[model samples]
Target: MSKVYYTPWRNDLEMVDKFNKILRKSNFLDNIEKDDRIAIKLHIGEYKNFAHVHPLYIKGLVSALLEKDCEPFLTDTTTYYCGHRFSAVGMLKNAFYHGFSFANIGAPFIVADGLGDDKGFSVKVRSPLNELFVPNLFREVDKMIVFSHCKGHGLTGFGGSIKNVAMGCVTKKSKLDMHKVVKFCYNDALCDGCDACKDVCDREIPLMENGKRNLSLEKREDCMHCPACMEACSRGAIKLEELEKIAQVLPLAVEGIYKVLGKENVRSINWGANIVEYCDCMPFPGRTIGKNTGIYLSDDIVAADKAFLDDVNKSTFMIDGRPDPEIQTIEGEKIGIGKMDYERVIL
Candidate 1:
């Protein structure tokens, strides 16, 4: 079985010191060889969303890797959504403003998918997506450290190593591709003209009257496909369909990472502190769901995520109407990302 090493969320020790101890206990970096170019894949968060993994912790890991003579750098991809991280220049500026400077983190920050969001290889995976555009940076790296800040997601319930790999490792187009799988449609014939869809749609995408709409659903796709209209309509006018593929499709991106970098060459480290309600992508983020959990390190991505979510569920299950966290692990295992069973090693 996979082994997940643990360390308490304590402030008694410096962040770097605690990180080093956990790394030693878990042997998380044992696979990295000297002179290897390692990419430390991470989510640096959107503008002012400060719950991301601290740079000091990453600096500690970088120091350890440097001591072993391995070449390491921090990397994350562009966001498909229009925001601070939508482009290479914008992302770099935001990362710098967020204190992820090369001077502070002991490594340079790289926009993995490149400036135009056009550097990648199409590798095959499973259902919901045939292939993913694994960024060229991921393909070139000798190894990767998937460092995640464990938190609740409005979509996947919990975002951890699996989410870090699936969403963070791909290009902009592939990110959009994963989201587009869930079909959203509304029938004008079923409308009761209650204006419920209009009230629920925060983006004002739905144009509902007695019957017929001037705009099509295709035009609504330009906005975030949250499709809140499907739920508020008592008349069954709108139907947003998905088979939990949103949860399953995320793991396929991990398969793409494995296809290029090899599973053995990756390690996962989750910062379970600052447990919050939504993903770091949100501008306002969300409220904290539980007390600060500690850290988890494992080679098995699914195992690490499972352990983290298990702890979160002890206090609260649903952070903010998100899907159950178990669904992510179950779907991940179903798609052969990693096993759910694991042996826990306390540091």
Candidate 2:
């Protein structure tokens, strides 16, 4: 079994010290070599969500990396939806807005996909998506530290280290491809003509016709696959299909791990603090679902995510009345990435 190091979050000790101790206990820094350009892959949170992994913890990681004479840079990819982080310029602004400035974290911040979301290289994987477009800069890094915030998600059940690597490292086109399985349709019988879907849709794909909403194939083609429309429908007029297919996307993340840093050269960390019901991509804050479960670190992405989901499942929180987050780990194990079973080592 793989080893997963964990440290409970305590109010007494400084967070920086707690984070550094976890890193050291996990031997995350020991894997780095002198002068290695380490990519600290992370989601810097959306415009207004404060639930993202605190920048202070990242500062601690950067300090630890620097002590080994290694170079570390904080990076994330642009989003497919129209939001603060949809473009490189907007993403940097949003990062700074969320207090991820170089002055704050002691490391440079870069949008892995370039200015216009056009910079990327492709990698082939054995999945419905035979190939994925990874960020060009992410491919060039010698090593990577996947720093993710554990939280609930509408589509994938939960987001953690595995979700971070699969979606966060890839370009927008690849992200859309993975999300293609999430197709939506309108239930005219349940429609109350609220136009709630139109109000929340970023693509303005939902159209009102004959006192009900209709989404054309051409309009749905531009859908970002976000759950805004599904969630906004009070009467349950909108229906979604193929949610289980989200598990198929895990191979992209598994392939990304091998293509980018290789399994041995990467360390995965999940911040279980401020566990929210929705992903950080939301423009608004979400309700806290699970209580703080602390942090988890492991070289095995599958094990780390499985352990994290196990903790989340222990809580009363449920996404769509079900704990659907384990699919990624189950699918990951089937793809020969890592094991679902692990030995937990608390520090």
Candidate 3:
């Protein structure tokens, strides 16, 4: 059974009606309980990125949840890199700047991983990697209404509900480990005695001498793997190794999500309209990839992602990698997370 439910983008006036029809048709709303502490998991968009799940849509969803007596709260995890969303204060400011205020979205925004990047509770899970996650606030909640703006990612090829939960709901420490696939290698031959890597090294992993420089993995152990050094290099000598390890993190990435929400207690809704090439992590907005494809709702996270991928594939527009792309959510499915084959219900 295809799990994708879709509604075309009509006039803005019909947005709430269209969403309700889609939600009702999908039957996902049936799962909510009265007065349920529903965690409305979402990305509040970066500083300048306007291409996120619209606040209007969120307010509609919030209204729907309120009707069910579900106490919905907007939620997301902070970033690993020191940025706008690295701390509760920063995330709140970014949320406010992006129009995620209680007045606008009708829900209080909460940073799930606590005030700092290190705050979270660990949960054990069964995986080849034995991925453990610091279960965030969503874990304490009774139910979750997962929302995502489907888009492409530099690493995952695409980002959807699974990506939303995996990366958006976990602590920055986990993100550092997951994204640290590539290691920077110093090119002694290209070294110009600039010691550029040493200067910008947030983890202080690189050391500089009178005329040469050396990098230590022991010191770089705290590296968040954000690739800042790759851009700062003046000689363009720093090389990345173990590139293959980067892709491996995708599957392991969702383990934390699975650990927190589990399969039974979560439902997903994704806004595929205005699909973009890059993720919402960008502080600045980018170009849209395809036509408005409406929204989808499902209890199966992998199924929702696969269904969204299929919609992207069916489109005539090219998004670098869309048509016949490998099922990126297979890693989640392999771990008994969710199904991929779905029943598409077009509304």
- TM-score for each prediction? 0.87, 0.95, 0.83
Candidate-wise lDDT, in order: 0.80, 0.81, 0.71
Per-residue lDDT of candidate 3, residues 1-347 (tens digit):
53667776676668767896666566778888898898998998877887888888888888888888778999888887766777889889988988899999888998887886555766654443355556457657888878998876544456778778777776776677667655656678887767667667656766776677766657667766655565467786776555445444555656656656666788888888667766788655456667666788888887887777776653433233222223447666776777787887778
Better of 2 and 3 by TM-score: 2
Specify the poorest-scoring 10-residue window by lDDT in model 3. Answer: 316-325
| Deviation from truth (RMSD, Å), model 1 | 3.7
Query: What's the alpha carbon RMSD for model 2?
Result: 1.7
lDDT of 3: 0.71
Between the candidate structures 1 and 3, which one is better when assessed by TM-score?
A: 1
Candidates in order: C-alpha RMSD to true structure: 3.7, 1.7, 3.8
Q: Considering every candidate listed, which one attains the maximal lDDT? A: 2
Q: Write the per-residue lDDT of candidate 1 for residues 1-347, one digit (tens) a residue.
A: 99999887777256558878777656888888899999998988999998888778888888889988999999999987767898999999988988889999889998998894775888987765887887777767999999999987756667889988998888877887887776666676777677777776556766744454434557666655553566577887666556256767887788888989998888899998888877888765578888777889999999999988767663364633446677778877887879899998888
Which prediction has the highest TM-score against the true structure?
Answer: 2
TM-score of predicted structure 3 = 0.83
Scored against the true structure, residue 250 in model 3 reaches a CA lDDT of: 52
Stretches off by above 4 angstroms in model 1 are 12-15, 183-215, 221-243, 314-320
